[model samples]
Each structure stands twice: as C-alpha cells, then as structure tokens.
Target chain A: MQAYLTLVRRELGGYFNSLTGYVIIASVLLLLGFSFTDMLVKLNATPTYVPLTELFYSSYYFWLILLLTAPIITMRTFALEKFSGTYETLMTAPVGDLQVVLAKFTGTLLFYLLTWLPLLGCMVVVRYYTGEATLLEPRTTLTTYLGILLIGGLYMAFGCFASALTRSQIIAAMIGFALGLTLFLLSLRSYMPAPPTDWGAKVFAYIAVGDHMESFVRGIVDTRPVVFYLTVTGFFLFLTLKVVESRRWK
Target chain B: MIVRPIIEVKNLTKRYAGHTAVSNLTFEVGRGEVVGLLGPNGAGKSTTMRILACFLPATSGTARVAGYDVFAEADQVRRRIGYMPENNPLHLDMRVRDYLRFRARLKGLTRRRSRLRTEVVMERCGLKDVDRKIIGHLSKGYRQRVGLADALVHEPELIILDEPTIGLDPHQIRQVRQLIKDLARNHSVLISTHILSEVEMTCSRVLIMQQGRVLAADTTQNLQQIMSDGGQVIAEIAATTEDLRACWEQMAEVEHFNIAPAEGSYQRCALTPRGSFDLRPLVYEQARLRGWPLRELSRSLHSLEDIFVHVTRAQGDGEGEEGR
Candidate 1:
C-alpha cells in the first residue's frame, strides 16, 4: 500500500514539476474557450431547445481535445522511465507489478480529469451570462462529467499500454494516437449513411462513445457504457502489468 | 553455533536467446564479509547481481539470499537486499532528499522511518549539502553518492553494488571506497569491479570471473599465495651476468633464474623458488659466502593483478583448445 501511494505521488508529481502539466492545462482551456464561444454564438443566432451542456458536448473541438490530450498526458508514464533507465530501479524495489501499473493508470487518469475542469468553469460562465440556472442543471452536469471520466479512463489506460511497449515517448504517443483514432472511428460506424441493420450495427452502437455521451448529457444513466469502459480499462491495465513483468525474464 | 552465509548460489545460469550470460556459476558470501566480483567487461557480473537482487531470474539453478529463495520468495529477498545497478539509474528530475525518501518508502519504511533513514544516509554519504538539488543537475560524483545513499536508506542486510566506481574520478573513487569500507561494519557488501587494486583494498574475499565462469574465489592473500607458491626473489650483485646465472643455477631451491647486466659490473638476477619457502635468507647467505657486494635483495610477492591475469589467461587458453 505504501509503495503504491508513493509511486502514484511520484507519477503525479512528474507532471506538475515540469512545464508539461501547465502547457496541457493552457491548451485545454484555450480549446474549450473556443468551443464555448462558438456554442454561445450559435445559440444567439438561432436558439435551440437543446441544453448548453449538450451543445458543448456536441462540439467537434470537444472530441478532438479528448482524443489528443489523453496520448499527451500518458505518453511519459512508462516510456520516460525506461528511457532514463529508471525502470530497473523501480522494478527492483519491493513493489509489485500490479501496484506500479495501477498507480500510473490512476495518476494519469486524475491528471486527465484535471484538464477537463475547465468544462465546469465554462458552464458556470455560460450560466452567469445567460442568467439561466437551467444551463447548470445538477443531474445533467453530473452525468456529463461521469461520461467524461469513463472515456478518459479508458483512453488513458490505452495510452499507458502503448507507453509500456517502447522506451521512446514519441513512439508511444504515436501508437496511442493511432489506437484512440481507431477506436473513435469504430464508434462512428453506427452513424454511417447506410448503417447495417444487423448484429454488426448493434455491436457498433454498444461500443459507440458518441451515443453514450449523448445519453449522458440528456441526464440518462445507463449501465452498459459504464460496464464497457470499466472492463476495457481493466483489460488494458492488466496488459501493462504483464508487460512490466515480462521485462524481467527478457 | 553456525552462522548462515548472506548469499549462496548453486549452479546459477542465465541464457539469452543466442548466448549464455552466466553459466553454472556458484559462490557464497558469508555474514559481514565484503566480497568483490572482479572481472573484465562482459564477464556476467552484472547479470549475476541482477538475479540475486530479484530483478532477473536465472534460467536453471538456485540462489538464496538471507535464507530466502530468490525466485520463490522474491519479495522477501528484495526487502533484505539493497541493489544499485550498473550505471546508477536515478530519476533525474527528483531532488536528492525526495528521491531517497521515495526509495525508502518503496522499500517498506514507514513515513517517519523513511524520513529518518533518508537523513542518516544523506549525512553518511556526504549528500547533506545538495539534498535539495535536482539529480540531473548535479555532478557525476554527487549523482553517484546519491545512488549510494538511496541504496543505504532502508538499511538492508546485504547491499549489491554493480560497478559502483566505474565512472568516478580518482578522488571520488577513494571516497566511495572509504564509504564501502565503513558500510562493511553493519552490512555485507557485494561489489563488482574489474579493478584488482580495489578488491585488494576493500574486499575480504575476491571472486575472479572470466567468460561467465569463476576463475578463482579466495581471499586476496590466499590467491597471492596460491598463484606464487614460493614467491620470487630479486638480487642485484656486483658480478657479471654469466657468473650470476651460473651461481643461481647451482642452488637446488631455485626453480628458474633470469640474469641481466646492470650498472658497471653489477648483474640483476630474478629467481623463482621451487617450493613454498622464503628464498631471501638463502640468497643473502649465498652472496655473503661469495664475498660479492649486494645492493638489492628482496622477495617480491605476487600481486592480485598477476593472479587475475594468470587465471583468466589460463582459462582463455583452455577455451581456445576446446574450440579447436
């Protein structure tokens, strides 16, 4: 337990101690700011019945930021340690492989969530300017953040798995970006013009992150997406643990 | 009562995909003993140390550390051994104090205990001044000290240091040697280096390896005695080279002799004895009986370097013949 906490603290400190953390935060806020203004302008031009949170989630910038930031945030988790030769030192300690992997996953997931705190701030700003308390509806906002957490958790685990495969951060990021893009594209199959009305479409809809978030912003709490994200996150984390252990034999 | 050895290995071997790194190697380090693994590069010293540290597993053989099997009870073994691997890898972004403290905690120390051990090791390693400096910015010597400090923070029973002084300057090497000697009072140290002088100075026993095999394992003194059974005698006498060679050839105790002309009429003769006996007194008497003026008469004992070279060279020849 102590080893796990110390590792987690060091992992998180790794981000805040360097300029990477601040740069990530600044870029996230800038992108969200653009999305917020665009949403407000569209609302003023032709008022829609959709809530502000739904409009924010529907922005192209939102998904782009989510996909890009995950790879960036987790690219250094295992890759930097290996490149610096610290992986041997870390693995030789009395800590278990599972502890190290889970700590990294949790640390990156927390930092990923931190970059999205601006989404709440943007909501507050929208509510203040529009003088509409409905824009800050408690249930809708909570579910939206939950969806963000689930998707962010899954993507961060994927990035960590990629990082564990190599010692170069650039390669790790490229692999992570490719994996995230593939998953996002797979989720888009349900939205095709001639979507297949078969079991294939059902599978696509089941894994579709877009449809999940749409229901979340509408204040619907479904168990399917929650289970799916948790299971996939667990699977990737398991693979990372095995990778760390396999280094010993090799 | 019998005291158990701190480390014991039985036929330990590690094979990579194409080649064997450590093959059928075996040695033991007793309690409170400082053993030096002396070998040239690629001798499998680091690989053996990694297996004992629980960082790597042996392909076939058994290793026990502090009464625990390395592979079966790795966690128990890890907690009892402090390992500073080759190149001394550390998190460069961390401060010295922070890194030591983190390592202490990772090694299973409580918060208060980790803080106390961190301070103790810092003081012992002379790292108090730069405890706040980032590791990457420090000089190589200071970084090496930080690595030593981290290894000591948890107070393990055995400390495995792989090539600890490889990159240090002369001054830093002296400091590190002194530190290792001081640590010998409380912990058993297993240090590996190719420098024979370092083993002579700091280690109680030496394990000389060649091509992933133990060439010789004994105390430095024993190795010297074993390699040079009767030792060698050097004498400078006021005589011709031919005359000195003739005189040495008549002595039954002398096995071989080399004589060369020195200054003026003096001749220098080096004599190897036939058995484990001191030839200095006999040489002195022979010179006095002949009424020859003798300038230098000394018995030269073999140094660890000669034994290391001799043993490794012998092994290399045996391997060459096998290959043929």
Candidate 2:
C-alpha cells in the first residue's frame, strides 16, 4: 500500500513539475472558453428556450477538446519513464506491477479531472452573463460531470496502455489518439438507422459513448453505461500492467 | 575468509533468439566480500548483473540472493539488493532528496526512516550540497553520485554496481572508488567494470569473463601468481636478429623468443623460459660467451592486462562456435 502511494505521489509530481501538465491545462481552458462563447452566442439567438447546461455537453468543441486532452494527459504516463530510463529504477524497486500501473493511471486521471473544472467555470460565466439563477441544477449537472469522469477515465486508461506499449511519447500519443477516436466514433452507430439484428443494436448502444452522456445529461443513472465504462477502464488498466511486466522479459 | 556466500548462482543461462547472452555461469560472493566482474562489452557482464538484480529472468538454472531464489522470491531479492545499473538511469526531473526519499519508500522504508536514510546516503555520496537541486540540471558527476545515493538509500545487504565509474573524471572516479571501498566494510558488493584498475583498487576477488563465460575467478594476488607461473625474460642484445636467435636457442630453458629490430644493430628479444627456471643467468652467459654486447636484461612478470588478453584471446576462439 505504501509503495502504491509512493508511486502515485511521484507520478502526480511528475505531471505538475514538467511543462506538459501546464501546457495541456492551458490548451484545454482556451478551447473550453472558445466553445462556451460560441454556445452562448447560439443560445442568445435561438427562439426556443434551451437549458444552459445542455450547451456544456452538446457543443462539438467540448467533445473535440476532450479527445485532444486524452492523449496530452496520458502520453507521458509510461512513455517518459521508459524514455528517461527511469523504468529500470522503478521496476527494480520493491513495487508490484499492479501498484505501478494503478498509481500512474490514477495520477493521470486526476489531471484529466482538472481539465473538466474549467467547464464549470464556463458554466458560471455563462450563468452570470445571462442572469439565469436556475441554470445550475444539481441533478442534471452532477450526472453530466459523472458521465464525463467515467468517459475520461476510460480514455486515459487507453492512453496509459498505449504509453506502456512503447517508449516514444509521440508514438504513444498517436496510438492513444487513434484508439480513443475509434472507440468514441464507434458509439455513434447507435444514432444511425436501425440495424439488421437486435443484438447488433444492443452492441451499438453498449459501445456508444455519446448515448451514455445523453442519458446522463437527462438525469438518468442507468447501470449499463456505468458498468460499461468501469469495465473498459479496468480492462485497459489490466492491459497496462501486463505491458509493463512484459517489458522486463522482452 | 570462508563466510557463507551472500549470492550464489548455479548454471544460470540467458538465451535470446539469435544468441545466448549468459551461458551456464556459476559463481558466488561471500559475506563482506567485494567481487569484480571484469569483461569487455557484449561479454554478458550486464546481462548477468540484470539477472542477479531480478530485472531480468535467466533462461535456465537458479540464483540465490540473500538466501532467496531470484526467480521465485524476486521481491525478497530486490529488497536485499541495491542495484546501480549500467549508465545508472535516474529520474532527471526529481530533486536529489525527493528522489532518494521516494526510492527509500519504494524500498519499504517508513516515512521517518526514509527521510533519515535519504539524508545519510546523500551525505555519504557527497550529494549533500546538491540534495535540493533537480537531477537533470546537475553535472554528470553529480548525477552519477545521485545514482549512487539512490542505490544506497535503503542500505541493502548486497550492492550490485555495473560500471559505477565509467564516465566520471579522474578525481570523481577516485572519490567513487573510495566510497565503494568504504561501502565494502559492511555490504557484499558485486561490481562489474571494464576498468581493470578499478578492480585492482577496490575489489577483493576478480572474476574475468569472456563471451558469456567465466574464464577465471580468484584473488588478485592469486591471479597474478598464476599468470607469472609461465615466466618471461626480456633481453636487449646488441646483435643481428639471427645472432640473437642463435644465442637464445643455445639455452635449453628458452622455449621460444620474439625478436624485434631495435636501434642500429640491437635486437630486443623476449624469451619465455621453460618450467619456471631462471634464464637471466643463462642468457648472460650466452652473451658473455659470444661477446654479444648486452644493453638491457630484465624479467617481465605478467600484469592483469597481459593475463586478460591472453586468456580472452585463447579461450575466446575455442568457444566461439558454442556461443552461436
């Protein structure tokens, strides 16, 4: 347990001590600010009343920023350790593979969570500018935040697994971007016309990240999406542990 | 000096796809003994050290470190060993104190104990001045000291150092050498280095490896004695090569000799005397009898370099086929 925490602390320190962490945060904030302004402009012009919180999740810019942030936050988790040759120092220490993997995953996940905090800031700014007191509904707001957390957790774990697959950060980022984008886009099949079979529709619904967020934004806490995200997150973290362990052998 | 071996290996081998890195190696380092693994590059020194450090597994056989099996009880082996790997990899972003503290904690030290050991090791490695400096910003020598401090943070029983002084300046090298010597008083150290002088200065016993095999293992004095058993005689004769050869051939103890053209008419001849017999007097008599002017006469005892070259060359060619 102590070894796990030690690794977690060091990993967290690594993210903040370097330029990568600040750069990712700055980029995400800049993109979110741009997206919030665009959303506010549309809300002002629309005739029908739209929930302000809906704009936070419905904006294309928000999803794009999330996709971009996945690789940035996770690219260095394992790749930098391997590149700087610190992997040798890390593995030779009396820490298990699981502890190392979990620490790195959770550390990057914390930074991933921080990127979303600015979205809330955008929410407050939007509320103040529009003078809408009821814009901050706890039920809808909390579920959306939970939905983003689960999706980010899964994406960051994918990034973690990609980083462990190689020592090059560029390649890790590329792999993470490719895998994250593919998995995310695959979920869009749920919104398309009805499939030929019932199981096919179910599979599409099961994998659709957009459908999960839509359900969450509607204040529905279904077990299917939660189980799907958690299982996928756990599976990727497991794969990361295996990759790190296999490095010593090969 | 027959203390129980702190590290014991039997028929340990590591085979890659195309070639074997370590082949049927067996050796032991006793308690408080400093053993040097001397070999050229690609000679399996690093491979053997990695296997012992539990960073890599051997393809066959077993190794017991601190009385625990290397494969079965790797965590226990890791707990007892302070391994400074080749090139001494480190987290360049970390501060020295923080890095050492992290390493100490990872080595299973309590918070208070980790801090204490971190400070103690930093002082020991002459890193107190740069304890707060970022490792990446430090000079190479300082960074190397940080590596040492990191390894020593938990004060494990067995210390494995692979080329600890490879890139240090002479002054820094001497300081690290002195530190290793001091460390040997309490810990059983297994150091692998191509720098023969480092072994002579700091190690108690030397194991000469070549082509992934142990060619020789013995005390420094014993190795020197073994190499000197086949005595060599150096004589500078002021004569033609033919005349020098004739004079040397007359002596029954002189098996064979190499003659090189020296200044003017002088030829430098090196004679290998047969069966440990002193051939200086015999050569002197031949010179006196032939009236061949003798410029210099001396007996040459083999140094470690000479022994290393002779053994590695002789045994290397014989085992080349087996390695592939």
Q: Number of the top candidate by TM-score?
A: 1
Model 2 misplacement above 4 A:
A46-51, A128-131, A195-197, A248-250, B1-3, B236-248, B258-269, B281-297, B320-324
> What would the per-residue lDDT of candidate 2 be over residues B165-278, giving only the tens digit for each residue?
988999989989999999999999999999888898999999999878999999988888888876788888888777777767877888888999888888889999888777
lDDT value for model 1: 0.91
Indicate which candidate wins on lDDT.
Answer: 1
TM-score of candidate 2 chain A against the true chain A = 0.94
Candidate 1 TM-score versus the reference: 0.97
Q: Give the DockQ (2 decimals) of all models.
A: 0.76, 0.66
Estimate, for each residue in A19-62, the C-alpha lDDT of model 2 and write its tens digit. 88888889998988888878877877883344556666677675
- Taking the tens digit of each residue's C-alpha lDDT, what string does model 1 give over B1-324? 788899999999999999999999999999999999999999999999999999889999999999899999999999998899999999988899999999999999999999999999999999999999999899989999999998888889999999999889999999999999999999999999999899999999999998789989999999987877777888999976767778888999899988878888888888888888778998899889989999999887789999998899999898899999
RMSD of candidate 2 to the truth, in angstroms, is: 2.8
Counting clashing residue pairs in each candidate, in order, gives 0, 1
Model 2 chain B is weakest, by summed lDDT over 10 consecutive residues, at B242-251
TM-score of chain B of each: 0.97, 0.89
